[model samples]
Target: MIVQHNIMALNSYNRLGTNNNAVQKNLEKLSSGYRINRAGDDAAGLAISEKMRAQITGLERAQLNAKDGISLVQTAEGALTEVHSMLNRLVELGVESANGIYQATDRDKIQAEVNQITEEIDRISKSTNFNGIKLLDGSLGSSTANVDGGSAITATQTDATQAQYVGANAVLNGVTFASLTKGDVLTVTVNTRINGTDSAQTFSLTYNPDKHTQLSDLQDALNAQIKEAFGADFKVTDNTQVLTFEAKEAGADKAIVSGMSWTVKNYNDSASGVVVATGSTSMTETKGVDAYTTVSGFDGGATALTKTSSSADVEKNTLTINGQKFVMVKDKDAAANVNKIDSGINVIVAKDLDQAAADIEKATGIKVAVDGNNLKVFAPKGAASGGAGLTLQVGDTADSFNKVTVSVDNMSSAGLGVNGLTVTDQGIAADSITRVKSAIEKVSVNRGRLGALQNRLEHTLNNLATTTENMTNAESRIRDTDMAQEMMAFTKNNVLVQAAQSMLAQANQQPQQVLQLLR
Candidate 1:
């Protein structure tokens, strides 16, 4: 044996070091309870596990977000419940005022209560919030105005007349009513052109069976209403129980005839008054037009022209994009309004628009898209911030598909039209009753919308919880150390380390004996 180097001892010494390293690694994995403790352990697994851990964390946070969204919806809905109660109280007071037995002072007292209730409604709408984010107060509302409302707007426009309804304007057609009945209410629409624009004037004749039993009686009553409304310019005749209007002007086309259209309504169910429908053309042959309101000032000190009221057209909300000006019009009554819109100058107050931008582009060729926001420029719902509207992040990533958008309109007194309700007079009190009823409906509808949002968030939360649980399980499979398998490996390595140490000592002794032999 050579004293310079003991080859056997060297091999055993190297084996000891290898076994000790194995034991250390095994202990570490056991202590840490992770198969991928470091990059060296499992490079691919470490990367995958880390990514999955992030996803799990994100899912957990998303669940919390959904819960928060639900809480926000609840807060708004709860405030609306109080508003509903106040509206009901207003309805009660209005009904009481209608009783002629109540003196003017009593009516005054009812009006005071109404004013207070309206003020309280305004307070609740402005103050209701979740984590400092306003829920109602119109701050969270989309740019779309609910002037006519969704219920008023049809989801699908089937025909040209339906299309007219969509735009809230249509060409008036002349109609001769046939098969007149006792309970028929006829609407006489006359649209006269001034400066190439049709100004519409309408009068309605409600037929009572006791008063207007004959076709002549109905015809004469319409004549009387028209004479007062239209200046005795058109002549009406009931030939074989059919009413038609003729213009006194010599050069006017009989087709136009000032566009007199009679819409028949059978208010009484028992009374059979089926009016035959007839169609004619207007002087300009005007069609229906689309209307829209603009919200602008979306960038670097750009002034935002936000709509102050849904119904009130007093405030003009103009959007100037790329130097193209959009003007808000109160009256979308003319069919030329669509053509006016294409010129990029005419903007009208949109009413009863469900698909705010979609419907306008379909029937009318008006592209109603604006970018950016100002202080009043709220982000549109489901869209990224920089505009007005609330977006809830319900997903792990920045993908827009992972977010939820919420829209809540202003529920103030003026917003609901209950602010101007007065019961100081019987006739006004009777009108106030109708206004309060409408306000109650608005509150109920708002509550329903909030409830729907709460339900959606609840569903989102459940989905997140399930997704997080599954993802965590997958991550655990990849990253967690299996106790039984790891413990067995540890035991085997520990034994090998001890055996290596003993063998290393034996091999070193062999070298020591070489020195003894030399001596």
Candidate 2:
């Protein structure tokens, strides 16, 4: 009966507030369509949902990255396709030039086309880019050169001497100099072997009947031409009636004159100037070059170059030159093995000291000449002084994403092993055919690698998509609210709130009874 203490009304009011708060929460959830809109709604669910959302977003981004990777690969492959076609055409041209029916002028025309194609290949290699990133340039792959630790040899020089003829009565190689006229041109083709391959250079000497052109004058002119074309690689010397041409640098790698032929064109009295000596007949192989090292310096027998170790320590014993590492290994036969060098370079450690020296010279483009039991090693002529070798590193981790790296090598003519290709003569053309074939194989292999990378990226993209979809679904389950269920809850809470308000009113009326008693 106390009007001051309305406990029943107070309880009804508290219950009304609870029902109203519940109804408000239901309305919020229904409007937002999220069960866990904030941390207070569902702390544990919110945490899990946020983690899933992060994963979904990451997966989506990763898929995009993979697609980009695919596009890059496709771009590279397309460029290589053109390269493949051009290589095929080059092969055809090389074969065409090999026939005997084609004259020197015709061969020259074909060579011009070949040169143009080579330039085009280089242009493509330099220009082909994916998003401004060079694709076919040699920067992507490891440029490595393996040096052999065989018997170091000194430089050797082979000389070709020509007997000089001066007076009208004198004859050289069955050809009288008196028969030559002022306008007569002697075309000399010098064939040189570089890196186990033959390359030729043609030079013309114009005979002047007015100047009385001695053999010394001709020698000086030829030497100047050689110096200009080869950059100090060869020289010519003349004494009295003897004229000699020699490679400036000693060793097997030196550009030695393999063959030389001279044809007197537009000459007066062709029968009188018929040159007899031809095709390296005037050249003689000389021995006894200066040796820089003794046979005792090597580990194996004094005569043979052998490995010090029983097995190859590819990880340990390595020489890094020009950012490229050259690995030396021991063969099973206890011989010093240099087989790991590039296939283009033939470095074999043979029992014969001369053969071993030759092999080293051919492989490294360096001169190796034997001095008795000792061997001497000299750099190739015109080689850059203090030039560092190439370098290659494995397992580099500088990229942004975790991925397996694919190495794409240089796609230029030199990189493809077609540099300095000669399709002029039948012999040279035959050799060039083999070289072009090898180039084609290299391109094919590179294209195959690109295709493989593209396929792998496609798979990665698919996987990323699946992971993103699944994670998104999981996040939706944790965060999204069922509108239908929430609406039902809202209806129930609204009814409860209304009932609480009515009960609160009735409870207040009960307090009015005490007032009535007082009246």
Candidate 3:
């Protein structure tokens, strides 16, 4: 018997402490309603659960984001609905004016109504707000383009091809105007003239005169002697033996009014009846009238005059005036004229209004109207209303409407309205209404798509909830302790502990028996 070592007691105590720890852990699992409360409980389960929880939270938030997206789309669609309605009303008005029988006054009254609706459209485009952001009027789009002279201009166009010219003279005479073409349209105009006295009367050529060969080509030129005497400004052209000089710029009187005049003998056809002189005295006539100045008919048999003297009539030679005989005239004027007023409802798509306006002006040769969201430009007047001015529908992207055509004037010869307007044959308002209806349909389709997605998300959320519950149950089976089973084990261990104590006492009695021998 070694009193130094209490081996049995130590063994029993260690076993008790370990059993108590097991009991405590089971109790914790049952009470906490979780399989893994701490990393020590089930490190792998804890890690897996944490990741699942994060994903669940993120999925919920994603669902919320999708809902918000739908709302935005719906808001835009509703605004467009109103826009469509307005367009329908305008279509009806267009039909009312299609009847040619209506006088201008009647048209003006209808125009007033049209103008009012236009104003309303502008108001809507400017005022429609979605979560503090504008939706329908293209407010949230922009792009930057650089032009010459170290300047940058930002612009937006429904057509990607539309470009903004930031600098001066970026394009001259319609060639590649910029170092980077970037799909910009350029129109160039050149103003030049022909001089006669300096050389000979000459005609400038074009690429295809066969098509427009008969077009007039008259220009101003300087006379060799008078050009040197008076300097660069003394330019002249002749009409039937009469000479007229033009100044660099128009003033009180052209130079011919104050300059001396003479006629070479052979050049004056008055000597022959080939030409007649009515308003002159000698071989030369100097009424000092400018060319193409609308002149009234002759006063009583005093007919329109022509040069009548020709000094070298007997000799045959190529006719020359100021050196040469023929002068080519080219007409430089506006191609056509038609005025259009748009509400400029799409300014939001542009980086800046001024640059956008400038681009439209340059490309279309029309004045841009920036009064509101409606972009308006004067149409080529006399444009066959049929193929001329079409209001383009801008698509979702910046380039959607680039190629869309707008030919309002050419809607129909006989028209009540294109879509559903009540006008005579040939009204454009109806067609515009049709277009708006199409847009509405598109918006409706998109909304339907959102609705479907929302349904899917709801279903997904339900499935995720069910899966999370089942997964928790499975983990519990592996890591949780049943309280009833743990209580039964604790009761058994308690009985054992008491029995062991009793046995230990009995063993002590046995040791006392040995003590009797010592007595």
Looking at model 3, report the run of 10 residues with the lowest lDDT sum: 289-298
Write the number of the candidate with greater lDDT, choosing between 1 and 3: 1
Residue pairs in candidate 1 whose N, alpha carbon or C atoms collide under 3 angstroms: 298-373, 377-388, 378-387, 378-388, 379-387, 379-388, 379-389, 382-405
Local distance difference test, each candidate = 0.55, 0.53, 0.34
Considering TM-score, which of the candidate structures 2 and 3 is the better prediction for this target?
2
Instruction: Residues 403-507, candidate 2: write the lDDT tens digits.
Output: 645556667765675654667666567667877888899889889988998887777777777777787888998899988889889999999999999999999
* Each prediction's number of clashing residue pairs: 8, 15, 55
TM-score of each: 0.56, 0.54, 0.41
What candidate 1 gets wrong by more than 4 Å, as runs, is 1-3, 146-387, 512-519
lDDT of 3 at 212: 23
lDDT of 3 by residue, 211-265 (tens): 2211112122113433444343544555654444443433534332222221121
Q: Please give the distance, in angstroms, between residue 519's alpha carbon in candidate 3 and its true position after superposition.
A: 4.8
Prediction 2 global C-alpha lDDT: 0.53
Best by lDDT: 1
What range of 10 consecutive residues in model 1 has the weakest lDDT sum?
A: 149-158
Off by over 4 Å in 2: 142-402
